[model samples]
Target: MTDTRKSTQNAVGAPGRAADGLAARLVVERGAFRLDVTLTAAPGDVVALLGPNGAGKTTALRALAGLVPLAGGHLRLDGAELDRTPPESRPVGVVFQDYLLFPHLSALDNVAFGPRCHGASRAEARAQAAAWLERMGLAEHAAAKPRRLSGGQAQRVALARALATHPRLLLLDEPLAALDARTRLDVRAQLRRHLADFEAVAVLVTHDPLDAMVLADHLVVIEDGRVVQEGTPADIARHPRTDYIAHLVGLNLYRGQARGHAVQVDGGCVVTTTEDLTGPAFVAFAPGAVTLHRERPAGSSARNLWRCEVAGLQSHGDQIRADLTGELPLAADLTTVAAAELDLRPGATVWATVKAAQTHAYPA
Candidate 1:
């Protein structure tokens, strides 16, 4: 119901405010759940919708592509209304989460299908499809069936199919969700390169913070079917407004009332922050900033220390991450050798300390 176009402005593309792109207000209802989100992207911009599962990210994408009709609000591309346009008729292309390549068709045929549907002659469609496959570096697999192609190759074919239509707006739904860890890295890099080459407006839905940060020009964080936060990836990572985002960014976050350098968290402990913020404030710090000791230290300069019991521990890359709960619930990262020397494990009591300067405080 709110028109946030004027309020939620970020520096878009080189064209500034005059650039042609997508501006959509999506409203849909399914029984008790209602999704209402406003999205904007200028040409040459790649916007990533980042959110938890069931937060209506995919529904918003479907609404824009006309796969699902809007119960209310409007859909526009450039300056044209497309609320009534069929999925195939709109200048929008989609790369579905599953890739959704036809099992019976060859890679070339699959990529050519979109063009063929738009009245291109078979020869023309196939020629365009071939060019796209070559661009994707999958020209050799043109004759291979979907089953014969690797996961990364199939993903490229799906992208090629979506781009072959010459759409003004591109929608990608969890484009790398299906790939394995190793394949995802390569596919993600390739996808980023292709996205950079695209000149139109593109919107992608992803729950991974790293994916959004690496692939998008702007991040729109959605929660419970509404826009919770919107900004550049760096801005969001530095100052997360919500606990979910903080967790996603791998930081321990707390909301409290701040007076001078101290913030009284709702739970019990008072966190010392570098900034002197007032009223409602948030304190956040990375796990790496926390130093864990098996016994209390005698002459530590750390202003914030918590006597916590290790609730769990896990391997995070080359470091060990410890989950602690007591006076202040937080996570700490230590080297594997340090973890071994400290003999850290579940239910171990430890002292955690963080310097005041390491904690960041901002208006909530």
Candidate 2:
């Protein structure tokens, strides 16, 4: 393990350096799969790990909390090396997806459990737990058991318990995955406020893009156990580098060769963009930018047009999303009234047009 760590450090060019907040290059191996991700964040920063299932998001969280052993690399928090520390001795708190509160214990006792485990007296632990519950707005349910509490109330109690431990690093795994839509809204806002007030580093693992955008200051998108992209929410939404990210941000993306203002994309289709570029490039546009016509209109001002066949249709809020395939495969959004007027259906033929100004092209 020591040799592996040395090699990893040499490869990445950073080792044995102490820094404030959380800095880690997590490397874990399981059978045929390996996860190697480097993450750094300052105090009061909320970082989210987002990816599809089996992408090692949960594994990264577990490694940070000392629940999984690191095969290589280093783990440091506030200038302290914790690669060999046991889970119980690490200054970390974890909130699982299921809110694993003791079923037989009252809310107050559940919150006090951590303090008591850390050698606090009964009175001191209860006092601290009471203060935390009050802060979470669950003081009225102090005596209620986990089974008797609402989903949102139980989640608060779990958070209070984790916070009571005075951990420097907090880990949340799918924190809002268990809540209903309405309850999730309320709890998400509350969690964001609490995270902002927290003075330590927090790492959240979730698959929901909306949750990541709403709660995290930084997003690390992992795919196949590697860090594919990392950036602020707005920056990522505007410039997506991968197909998964483009889908997550609701954009049609393609890669091709660029010559001046025109890009020759896949299937021999050319896209005209306002930005002039050369060499390898990427073109992206939103579904709303596409206009569908039953017949190819001559003398149209649009610079980009495609002959397509409707592959499918789905409802998107007040609009209808038409999936097209032929010369170019893409999605188009139109009002229900417009869709009816065009008589759009599966296997129907249509001509799609997108203005050059609406297409964004950049270096790949």
lDDT of 2 by residue, 310-357 (tens): 999999988999999999899999999999999999999999999999
| lDDT of model 2 at position 297 | 77
- Listed in order, each prediction's TM-score against the native is 0.93, 0.93
For residues 154-243, what per-residue lDDT tens digits would candidate 1 score against the true structure?
A: 999999999888778999999999999999899989988888767678899998788898989899999999999999999999999998
Candidate 1 lDDT at 84 equals 97
lDDT of 1 at 359: 97
Q: Which residue runs of candidate 2 sit more than 4 Å off their true CA positions? A: 1-19
lDDT of 2: 0.90
Residue pairs with backbone atoms closer than 3 Å in model 2 (clashes): none
